[model samples]
Target: MTRILVTGGAGYIGSIATHMLLEAGYEVSVLDDLSTGHKDAIDTRARFVEGSILDSDALTAALSNCSAVMHFAGKSLVGESVEKPDLYMQVNVEGSTKLLDAMKVAGIKDIVFSSSAATYGQPGDAPISEQSPTKPTNPYGVTKLKVDELLASRAVTDGIAAVSLRYFNVAGALQTSDGWLAERHNPETHLIPNIFKATPSAPLQVFGTDWPTPDNTCIRDYVHVLDLIDGHISALSIMKPGTYQVLNLGSGSGYSVREVIDTASRVAGRVMPSVDVARRAGDPAVLVASIEKAKKVLNWSPKRDLNQIMQDVVSSGA
Candidate 1:
């Protein structure tokens, strides 16, 4: 079996990817500090190594004898990045470099990095493609884009095959209930889960209903967790030495905040309460990905829609 080392394999998307890898007959080893990752989310098939990506020794050990590394460990909050820019740089940028160094020592060249659509910042057009200009509006995005640059340079210089999948808003849950991984951040900022948790009783808060969108609410491209993992796995299989690629992973459809809440309410068989509020800083009016490159290269497309995304979230009971 191909040995794959996944950083943050106990976290939301990482854990789901790890599960998929194991199911596909890969020997998976996970390296995570469990800072934001839940222990229960890890698949039993994967070997879990408790550590941070900042620790080169631990990373080296984890990468030893592995065929490739899937990096998902990093600070991911946009608002928090604005408040603590240094932390985002230290973890997302510096730590990613450290992981690369470890891979260099281990002679492992292939890497699938988990990037974000935030790297594009506020795109001037909807359905932004991989060729879109990356003018990140926040520190979180800045760090991710910097890592992409680093990976590109390293791929040319060190002969590393790297593919960064710039994901939009990753919502929904894994299909199986046996290993359900839900969003559980301290002071959570994601709209879907927060709205799901506050439905029927508490009113979901909608920020800045004055944006230039259809409902004056921020619109985001939602990708199912399963679809996102499928893209990662496909990228991992096709990555060639000295090759570098960046592709957007999203459903190519944008949904407003109100639409999401309404969909969730319908899925849950209950009416969800919500109120409009002032827009928050660094919040883009709309973020919809153009997934044509992903389809052309990886032959991947989102099989699930927004309604399926909401149903998955509701089913997870997370």
Candidate 2:
């Protein structure tokens, strides 16, 4: 069996990816620091190493028998990134460089990095492609884009094949109730989960309602977390040495915040209360992905809609 190391495999996306990889018959080892990741989210079927990407010795141990890596570790909150830019840079970029150095030492050649659509910042157009300018409005996106560039450079110099899966707003939960993967972030900021958490008294806040979108609210592409994991697996299966690719993993269709609120209310069979607030700094009015590159390169497309995503979230008991 091919063994692969998944950094942050104890986090929401990483844990899901690890479980799916194990199901697909790959030997799996998880490396995580438990900073933002939950220990219980890890699958018992795989080897688990409690470590961070910044720790060389621990990373080496985790990568011992691994042939490849799927990195999902990092601080991901855009608002937090803006508040703590130094922390974001230190962890996301500096720690990633350490991981790369360790990979070079371990002789691992392929990696599928969990990147974000935030790298595109506020695109002037809808349905951003891989070619879109990466003007990240926040530190988190800047760090991710830095890694993407680092990987590209290293691919040529170090023979490391890398694929960056630039994801849009990731929501929902595990497709199956395996009980090994779920979103459990402290102070949850995702739209759907927050919508579920909203009650008659404490309504969810909609940031930016005077955008150029149809509903005068910011529009975004929300791909199911499951579909994003599938893209990771697909990228891992076909990676070649000395190559680099960036694919946007998102639903091609765009939905406004108002639409999302309405849909969530419908899906949950209740009135999901929400209030419109002023636009957030560095927030794009409309940020959708053109999944044409993902379709062509990875032979992948998102299989779940917003309704299906909400249903999956509820089914997972999340």
lDDT of each: 0.88, 0.88
TM-score of 2: 0.97
Worst 10 residues of 1 by lDDT: 175-184
Residue-by-residue lDDT tens digits, candidate 2, 79-171: 899899999999999988999999999888999998999888888767899998889878888999999999999999999999999999898
TM-score of each: 0.96, 0.97
Model 1 gets an lDDT of 0.88
Runs off by more than 4 Å, candidate 1: 175-179, 199-202
lDDT of 1 by residue, 42-113 (tens): 888788888999998889778877989999999998889999999999999999999999899888999999
| Top lDDT model | 1
The alpha-carbon deviation from the true structure for residue 9 of candidate 2, after best TM-score superposition, in angstroms, is: 0.8
lDDT of 2: 0.88
